[model samples]
Target chain A: MTVLDQGLTPPAPDLIPDPAVLDLSAARRDVDATLAGFLDAKEQSAPGPELPPLIALLRRFLDGGKRLRPVLCVCGWHAAGGDGDPAAVTDAAAGLELFQAFALIHDDVMDASDTRRGQPSAHRALATAYTANGGQSDRAEEHGLGAAVLLGDLALVWSDELLHRAGLNVGRLEQVLPLLDEMRSEVVYGQYLDLQTTGRLSDDVDTALRVARYKTAKYTVERPLHIGAALAGASPGILAACSEFALPLGEAFQLRDDLLGVFGDPRQTGKPVLDDLRSGKATVLMALAVQRASRGELRKLRAVFGSPDVDEQDATAVRKILDRTGARQTVDEMIRTRREQAMAALDHVPFPAAAVTALRTIAESATARQA
Target chain B: MTVLDQGLTPPAPDLIPDPAVLDLSAARRDVDATLAGFLDAKEQSAPGPELPPLIALLRRFLDGGKRLRPVLCVCGWHAAGGDGDPAAVTDAAAGLELFQAFALIHDDVMDASDTRRGQPSAHRALATAYTANGGQSDRAEEHGLGAAVLLGDLALVWSDELLHRAGLNVGRLEQVLPLLDEMRSEVVYGQYLDLQTTGRLSDDVDTALRVARYKTAKYTVERPLHIGAALAGASPGILAACSEFALPLGEAFQLRDDLLGVFGDPRQTGKPVLDDLRSGKATVLMALAVQRASRGELRKLRAVFGSPDVDEQDATAVRKILDRTGARQTVDEMIRTRREQAMAALDHVPFPAAAVTALRTIAESATARQA
Candidate 1:
């Protein structure tokens, strides 16, 4: 039986409590410290100089992040009335950060994105490093790509090591492992859908939503919350409550991102406005536009949507079609609906007051942020 | 403390003893069955139709393998005198297979290899699948790489799941987790080294040997043995003995593979002979040839080596240079020396008689095989 099933809860297995119920900003700092300490240990223990370069890259890549998932994880722990010992929850949060790093590094390579967080993407940085190290010019890019893949892999395995080190007892372990497993499979399946759909403009709104749900809704939100709850040895009712709140909020978060990818200022978003359209990112917004487009607009979209050489003028033309077809407005309405639904979920459960406030703040920022 | 450190061993926590002392052939079947069952469960529980194609691809890819790692894992268990149920150990063996699959899939993508085991490599096959699925031709190859990376990742996580599900008790888990963690780091570091060295045509024998040791000897041979021994909660002395025997034998195994990769018959080896040379795989044999080559020969070597267009004539020229420089003969002697050292290690330890025989047979086959 799980910790919740027993008449009495178990004591801390190893780690004693760290300071708990910190506000979001404080929680971010703790997550960062845990990540830094873990990676510092890894670098110190690494056998050769060769690994330092990769480690350095990972540290740099991790420097810029919202830390939303990690913050949510800690909040979830609190929401479940998890008393004492936030250390393991902190480690789990750090692990979520590492997992995100792995996903982004690989995603950049897959998309051939040159920049991330306003710096060179992992592959780009590695390629520059290759050339700086006097590698053959012709082979540098391929070498960079290969190295990035390996680096991503290293990040992934290390994340698991962190999770394993969380000092959870058997009961807690049984609760967490399957949730972690499902998170991994879901994100990968989501990526698979994204890759297959990219470079092809389609009117399949269902697939587009499925992509959003798998990629963002569950992986980015629900799993982190669920993992934190599991770390607390939460009951099934608590986990189900997390899903209800997380799924709609996560979807709204992704919808906001899809909008920002196209319409938001690059200075705030840190990505070119044309990137999503140029890459033909499969999104509900695009699918809706495709569904409603006239023949002339459809032809225009076909010409510009996946074009590598697409100019601002071309993007403007596509944007006009989306506006004209009411697709953008519809997506805006969808976001509102999801945001309201997620807010309703929060009221249905009587979580800690602090956790409720944190969740509300997170939901508002996620749906309303410029970036 | 570990199971061995305790005054007396505890009973099996979950899995009861399966039959033990079976030869490698019988062990292979058990490992295969475990993997099949695990994967079958994954397929059934997967949420949608989208995952089935990827699952099918993985099942097909797994259909071909030597099962050497898994078999050695079982052998290590017996050698360590691990008594009682072999079920957990078998699950661990199966986990090793999935890990190997993960490694090979990503390696193929990194190397951009066209084939593996006489079939289209994972990326190539995945690309074919993408095109077959009505994906645009321009994006199909990229889709395949992304999918393969994801597929490899799934295999990796699933391997961890299998290991977790092995039903080993706390003592076994404590003993096993670190070894597993180290094995992962070592192999990735090895791959990183391999990527840096490939296509450079360096005469750095030390670096080349380091690559071989890290990439092959330790990862392919020693770790599997170590993990198996750990599963049995092997005493430190037995674990040390495993390393002594494994390292030299593993090095020899790699040396033999280096030779066969360039010289073995394609029909037997299931790989085109030109592959290793064309990829400029950093092997001690190549390093030795570079070190000893005349100016004229070095120029010819540079022109033909690492060339995608390298033909049989080019390979013949390289072979002639290798022979004339005494590189091939020197490698053969090195293999002989290492093999002898490994054989001598067997004499120092009083391993189970059956295990010693199995280890000897594996050593002979690994070092002497034509393919």
Candidate 2:
């Protein structure tokens, strides 16, 4: 499991006070249970029987995610001194997971990626479902793509529903809406930038990082924290602190992902290693390699980068070039620096001690985990 | 130029009352202005310059459509006794228009339709933009589709932003949010049902009607009316009346559209006659034809239905079969009946007289208009 999975191991209970308890694993379960319950309600209320299969597909797609955003959302709330029933924020955190599902389903469709988390991507699974349900083979692919798009749309709206239903009191609803809106816009913009940069062997590291900031650092990290903090009626200083802690950790998270996309074991990463190289994903890792590569190496990289037919041998060659150019080392250095920056932000964050401890563990897992 | 395109129309000044004013043309303009202003702020505050082209494309796409839902939303407000400061509902109405844009862009992408409203579809247009920006020709189509998905996501979120910014007060936000959420969910269900039935030649008239009801009736009409009335703190009776009028009128609108897809002139219809036939859209009209066709006629219909290469000649053959089976006349009869039902419902609606008059006009245009 990746850093954010929080796949259900209860934290030892003695260390924290009753009110400010921050159990990451239990939080993940609550988010998942909320998601499952929400979908169950949707399925029941659906106007027709045909909807259930799509809902089922979505349920399956949602199963393996580490649920990073949702976990961080809860962390942000507790960090800002939220107390009493955590139910409303849990619902909002669940909404963040649904939003992540929307983002990933659409992202897979855009990339035409064959698999996600070791399962057929949403579009592929949908296509298979089509033919399995008696659709002509010729129409299966198109049907799958259309269904996936619709599914993603459904997830997005449902996410909004959850967020709206979180039922925060005392006008907190109004306060959090704008933050959520900004989060959605930022992620979409980040995705758009990624689309622009993908399939192009670019040495533009700045644009790549901007994409990461919007797509991952802000979307995956900062916005969820800000939203949760805002829900708790956090002060400006607390919100700022959340951002300072989130941004660097988020970048480190993405940088690790980029590295793993090419270098990590498929069993561990839950994705084929060749996807990024084949799609020419404009990661900072690839950008630095391009910037530093020798002329012959650049030519070889060009031949394989963004090539749809890229295989293990070609990937190995690219890895060799990255190593030779010291680009990999640079990325490693960047990850280390970002991690340090994140850990340093915690020193004077003014959070509850328990929150600091929880966040420290998150930072460690985020920067160092294989998946 | 379909029935909903209140394309800057000016109703006779003598018709609608001042307090219950229903100037379709002016309302459309207000909605457009609101949309433009919102986008302007978004563009100015965007994190980077890359966002504008997508925004521009969306703006151009937003142009020329009849703002039917927005107009109906305002009419619903006025009908339900909303008064003084129509500004909030106007913003909400504009949000409806943005939602329509999101729906249409994604719809075109799903159908792989090359053109919409006589211009290249969003995916196609995005592909052109990619090539124009000197992207490799080979990747242009993929890039276009991906960008279109991102663009559509942007529009959906932006639509939510608009609705959120509508600035309702007095806990009215609570009343309206669920209605908006339901509207979104209903449309998605409709789209999914549409995908399931598309390209499958079937005589399941009930299923086809269900698809149309979800995709068009509730989504296109009832929900917009409900949302507007809810914003005005409409009572349950008023909400029920809105639905009574909306559902039948909405069904009539879809039935009329189905007819136009086949029989109406492309010049007036703003779409090719062959599109519906080519996609094998599971319309009530097609279901009727299939139900009634002679063996030989059914064979001819099946040959052209869902065939991607369907041309004018094939459409003509299919049209002949529809005429022979009397499906075309039956659909016309259904539209007329539904229109009557809508008119009948409006007669007893506890709305102001001006609302009745406005509803009558909408009913007439929705059933009888060409483009």
Considering every candidate listed, which one attains the maximal TM-score?
2
Off by over 4 Å in 2: A1-21, A168-171, B1-21, B167-171
lDDT of 1 by residue, B220-291 (tens): 778888778888878999888998999998788888888887777877666778888888888899999999
> Best lDDT goes to which candidate?
2
TM-score of each: 0.91, 0.95
Q: For every candidate structure, what is the RMSD over all alpha carbons to the true structure, in angstroms?
A: 7.7, 2.7
Chain A TM-score per candidate?
0.92, 0.93
lDDT string for model 1 (A145-240, tens) is 999999999988888777767634424767787888889888888887887788889899988888889888898889999998888878899999
Candidate lDDT scores, in order, read 0.81, 0.85
- lDDT per residue for candidate 2 within B1-371, as digits (tens), equals 12233232345677645755567777778899999999899888989989998889999989957788898898888888987887888888999999988988888788887887778989999999999998999889988898988888998999888788774453578878888999999999998998999889999989988987888899888988888888888999999999999998888888888888888888877677777888888899999999999998889888888998999888888888889889999999999999999999987899988777887888887888675
Q: Encode model 2's per-residue lDDT on A256-283: one tens digit a residue.
A: 8888888888887666788888878888
How much DockQ does model 1 earn? Answer: 0.56
Q: Name the lDDT of candidate 2.
A: 0.85
